[model samples]
Target: MTTLVTDTGHPVITAWSAVSPYGIGRDAYAAGLRERRGTVTGLGPEHGTTPDGVGCVVPGFGVREVLGKKGTRSMDRVTGLAVTAVGALLDDAERNRAVGTGEGAAFTLGTTTGSAQSMMDFTRDSLTGEQPFFVDPARFPNTVMNCAAGQSAIWYQLKGPNATIAGGRAAGLHALNYARRLLGSGRARTVLCGAAEEFSPARAWLEHRCLDGTDSADSAEGAVPPLGEGCAMLLVEPRAPEDAGQPVLAEILAVELGVVLDGADPRPALVTCLRSALHRAGATPADVAAVARSGAPGRAGGAETEAVHEVLGTAGPADLTPAPLIGDTGAAAAAFQAAALLAFAADRPQQAAGRIGVITSVDRTGSVGCALLRLR
Candidate 1:
């Protein structure tokens, strides 16, 4: 693999933070990964439609602790999670000068829906009300799919380009793809890219049904686990020769995408995507020290595993699954997997730094992609 650090256009993750099941910052999440412990909690029928399930939930998170009273009054869980994660990321990156006044800051996020709860509630209120006039105008904005990204921009005064993607499990990389294009064209100096998902009854029920519908005999019976919630944000900045001395978290070599048409095999698409990503990074499967990734259980899951093994030799210890530990994070899955790789490199530098890593994902809707990254 090519090992030079400077004179390349690769974007490096300068700073990152999260409000995950582990806690309010990346430290807690890192600790959880190191201990091989997942922070998911059991959710019985009382919590949602599932007879039995689990979820990676943040227990007793006080909003006032992160955002003042003014910020908590009119927020939904998705917005709260996004705002909280962005606040921590800005604080950690100390990008106030560049991002605070809407100077050169760009923001992008991924989400399935703005907030399932917000949309369902708003729609229900409209239909159940005596008339359309009875709907709450104040709550209308929360139903927009771009609410989180727009809210984050407004909260931080980021005036640069702000966008949101409707990517499912591929959301994180979708944001990365957009950020790369924006930055590559000199549209922005830096971009905060990530994805968020909030656990809700509507989301939980939908996921249960989706898992139940997966008829690919490869699944572990009908025992669909649980879902996870939270946001993962990364401060992606352009790499420069002079900034090489700074502590570089990870340099993104490339972001690759693939699609498997309906009623077709996904293994071919996945293999082609992985091969292209490695080739672009001037590396091969052997150069990838570890793969921080996971996939859906049935056919998608089986395809992902077979592709990795067929291309990378073996699925051995080098393969890591953050899902079993964190449950299924849906839109936030890719971001968390990327974070897991960075966390391993940071917390165990001696073993992980200077090594190439990749985060591969295969969403339910035939969307598949991987981000090639190297920790400095």
Candidate 2:
């Protein structure tokens, strides 16, 4: 069997990603990277009733405008974001003919809270016996963990093997790995790979309950790990050089997953994961130019990432917590980081030549995943 990196059949990232943060897009994201602009802002209540306190709020591009009225109503805000991002990806691909009818395209969506807000809302309405809240049965399909991927495929009219993986924060990278496998195995011609996470009171409550109150701070300011919202999509194809109009972002050098026990020190596991990813990519620590990390700002998560950096001797070029601008986007965090890496490579100095970009993530379950993206 050929190594994941050397398969030559390796999938290339073509048209990918439209991030929504304070009205940001590829251009704004690129500008932010070029100018080092930090867009992290405070978040108000989910319904916009509460005063703005703290957190990264997505600006620009409402879901209805992209997905249309019917599509928007069928999805929660998080899924709506995912659909919009994927829509952007497909639109780019369609313009270049990289995607077409019967092109055998697939989708892999990663997410943590799949319609949790919808469920919560439905539950509240049912508790009050308010006519069962008039939930559309058609939307029931989107209530599950894999709903994002399924909806993406339906929305884009892609027909191929599709799956969804939820490894918490690592879910996004895991989805990339899955897409790579499908392309490498000749299972599909093109794959739309992406991840999405929607912020919900239930999720925030749970995270707060899990985190040490001391480290927990409002998300608006430059707090280490602020809650974030958004979705990102990447179009992956088996061909290395296709006629796709969008610029080739980066080549997927290698991806690996490592699981640590519930109470074990994550440092060792993370180190092992990073080392394996680099080895598989035939790269060394020195070969990496930057590290795009989860940077959740959780005490353990932050400490564990720092320990990994110390092991690799990669001191500070790391893009820890893009949340200072994008906030923590749950499963989309890593994918967003991946998008950031693409943006970074698109404009960074050539001094980064021969240097690969590494994306790493750790979930609450103690699973760590790392992907090595080589700038081509």
Candidate 3:
């Protein structure tokens, strides 16, 4: 198994922020997790057609309202979520200083696609417009998959390398791995890495159709959870003596990403990733205090559970699955999984410090990834 590790020492996550179903910002997410609150709300006509009548949307989130109306006339839900999350991370006084703007700071975002809704909408407009090529010019930019990454850099003035990674449910892990590379290569001093997913009529219908054709456990019974939308950002920087007095959330020990082709069972591949990440991190199963699983539905979910249990045992580590509370977040799943680990560790610093928190993701698209984070 190939391990994605950096020789530049373990990069630390000093700060993070989220615009999630729980609410906006870091405190709101922590509070919601502590309160065990559910964020699913009924979808009204404004949401257009949806597979289910409900979804976990960021409450009261609007592009124009959150970002102001000046340059957001064409912003879509996914871009709005990404920008809002970056803003939330910068809101922290300490994190803001750590992530100085201009050529030193980089921005990386993960997504299955930039905005499914925007792409579908633009295509529909082109096909049904007065002429074959007649469509809204302002909405064209939203159709590309890298729009969010570019917009984030432009909005925040992050002049370093900008990137967008796509890996379905494993996208966030992919982004994190890329960020580690950037830091190790001395390409950038700081990287804002995270993933964003949006809920929309187009996305909902697309997922419903895809799931309907699958033989997955929940989809077979038509009992899958509602879709969720949000973005989560982490301020990642290489370890330095200047960060001695600063707060450290978690240290990225290792990351491993792999794939299983030809419709084979996913368990073995995930097992390899888990074992590889732990080995690279110089940790044993006993050192893992908790695991944040992707909580994917159907065969993917079952395979993930079995792989983790096979490696760590069923009762060895605390299971932290965010899907039940946040719904299916698509590409943002693994990021929220990491956030859940951070939140769980925040309340148990004594037991968590120096312990490993493992994050595993298995997506139906044949992607499998695991990340080992040493809690701080």
Estimate every model's Cα lDDT from 0 to 1: 0.78, 0.69, 0.86
User: At residue 356, what lDDT does model 3 achieve?
Assistant: 93
What digit string (tens of lDDT, one per residue) describes model 3 on residues 1-376? 2222333588888888889998899888888877888888998887887866899999988899889999999999899999889988897765474564676688888899889999988999888989968987888999999999899889989988899999999999999999998888778878899999999998988887777334345442224668898999998888875656657889999999999897788999999999988889888999999998887777778788899999999886887788878888999999988888888889778878889999999887899999999998
Task: Sort all candidates by lDDT, best to worst.
Answer: 3, 1, 2
lDDT of 2 at 292: 76
Error of 3 at 116 (Å): 0.6
Number of the top-ranking candidate, with TM-score as the measure: 3
TM-score order, best first, reads 3, 1, 2
- What is the model-wide C-alpha lDDT for candidate 2? 0.69
Off by over 4 Å in 2: 1-7, 22-24, 44-52, 93-97, 130-139, 213-224, 241-247, 316-321
Instruction: Report the candidate with higher lDDT, 1 versus 2.
Output: 1
Clashing pairs in 2: 22-59, 23-59, 23-60, 43-54, 43-55, 54-220, 55-219, 55-220, 228-328, 323-327
- Using TM-score as the measure, name the better of candidate 2 and candidate 3: 3
Model 2 worst lDDT run, 10 consecutive residues = 1-10
Question: Residue 72, candidate 2: how far off, in angstroms?
Answer: 2.8
Best by lDDT: 3
Tens digits of per-residue lDDT for model 1, 1-376: 2222222488788777888888888888888888998676776554455434667786656556567788566677888889888888777645433443366688999888879888998989989999967998878888999988888888988877899997888899999888888777777777889999988888877775666456335346223446788899888777766854444789999899887777577788888988998889998776777787655556677777778788787843266668777777889988888888888788767767777888888877888888888876
